[model samples]
Target: MVKKVTALKPKDESISAYVRDLIEKEHRARANREAAVVYQEFLDKNPEECAAMEVWESAPLSDEIEPRKP
Candidate 1:
């Protein structure tokens, strides 16, 4: 049987908090979809750079430890 999933707010959580969480989740999903389209275009234009792009993506991110100096 297929299961139906539902989002349950905590007993002590307020309505506004629940709504905010839902909105943030929706925004994150939308951003990921947009990013996928951009990445696809990049690949289409630079198929030869796939290896370098993969290496860069696999590298650990350092943005959190040190902000870019610009």
Candidate 2:
């Protein structure tokens, strides 16, 4: 589940700035939706390539894990 936390009003007192921020947020959301559609279409066209491309890469942090001894 996703949750949103609203930010407290900043000291900048400019309505124009607020409107600009809303516009930017809307544009970003629209772009993400469009990209999702394109990605789906690509996967439909090339399932094998898409499967290969879908691998997620990340680096591990914090070497903290319960150590086991054999």
Candidate 3:
């Protein structure tokens, strides 16, 4: 694994830097997966709310841009 990572990393990059980047990416993927599970559980528990949300999700966007309130 070390040999493969060293070979795949950029010529100017250090092994530690490359490994840290890989770890950070894996961590983010794991967190996103966990969040997705929680969101799905919420959707399952709230069928009526989910149905209401689907309506908003499928609604057409207005072409007129509203001015921001000061």
Candidate 4:
């Protein structure tokens, strides 16, 4: 008895577009990992500063900035 094999079809998206999207995703992931490591190190060295930053971020921002007269 002989067995029949089926071939898989390609997606509708273009190969270049798919590859570009994949590269962008990989780049973003790498950037995020690097940022996380840097942030972790910053937190380790300046725990107080990190807490202060969180507080500042949570505080409401002023909508108007005062202009200085020259």
Candidate 5:
């Protein structure tokens, strides 16, 4: 595991930095999954509202829509 971490870390990055980055990414992904499960449960409990949301979600954006600047 140490060898893999050393191999993957950037040339100038510390091992701890690389490991911290990996931990943060996994934490965010797990959070997203948990939020999705909660959202699905809410939708399952509200069929009418879910159907309305689905209709809106399926609609295409206009061609004139522009990306927001940072």
Candidate 6:
């Protein structure tokens, strides 16, 4: 899916533009993670829910989907 860039220019720019950049990136990453989890949940779930994870992983590589493991 193509995501069009939405500019968020807060008047006065309370924080610097650099900080805004960080916030935007982190937000996107967090949202992606939440989405991935919807796919990862396996046990204790209904049949269809468990299958969702498989569907996503089966797709071709496009971008980083997994969270950084320490």
Estimate, for each residue in 1-70, the C-alpha lDDT of model 6 and write its tens digit.
1122224454554445646787899999999999878755643366775577569779889867999889
lDDT, candidate 3, at 55:
100
**Tens-digit lDDT track for model 3 on 1-70?**
8899989999899999999998999999999999999999999999998999899899879767789999
Q: What's the lDDT for candidate 2? A: 0.70
TM-score for candidate 1, residues paired by index: 0.58
For each of the candidates, give the backbone clash count. 0, 0, 0, 0, 0, 0
Candidate 6 residue spans exceeding 4 A from truth: 1-15, 42-70
Off by over 4 Å in 2: 1-11, 54-70
Instruction: Give the alpha-carbon lDDT of every model.
Output: 0.78, 0.70, 0.94, 0.75, 0.94, 0.66
Q: Sort every candidate by lDDT, greatest first.
A: 5, 3, 1, 4, 2, 6
Residue lDDT tens for model 2, 1-70: 1112124335564555766787899999999999999989988999886767666333345658878988
Best by TM-score: 5
Better of 3 and 6 by TM-score: 3
Weakest 10 consecutive residues, lDDT, candidate 3?
Answer: 57-66
Clashing pairs in 1: none
**Candidate 5 residue pairs that clash:** none
Q: What's the candidate order when arranged by decreasing TM-score?
A: 5, 3, 1, 2, 4, 6
Please give the distance, in angstroms, between residue 22's alpha carbon in candidate 5 and its true position after superposition. 0.5
lDDT of 4 by residue, 1-70 (tens): 1111112223575556666776899999999999999998998899898899899899778667779989
Which window of ten consecutive residues has the lowest lDDT sum in model 4?
1-10
Comparing candidate 1 with candidate 2, which one achieves the higher lDDT?
A: 1
What is the clash tally of candidate 6?
0
lDDT of 5 by residue, 1-70 (tens): 9999999899899999989999999999999999999999999999998999999998888757778999
In candidate 3, list every pair of residues with a backbone clash: none
What range of 10 consecutive residues in model 6 has the weakest lDDT sum? Answer: 1-10
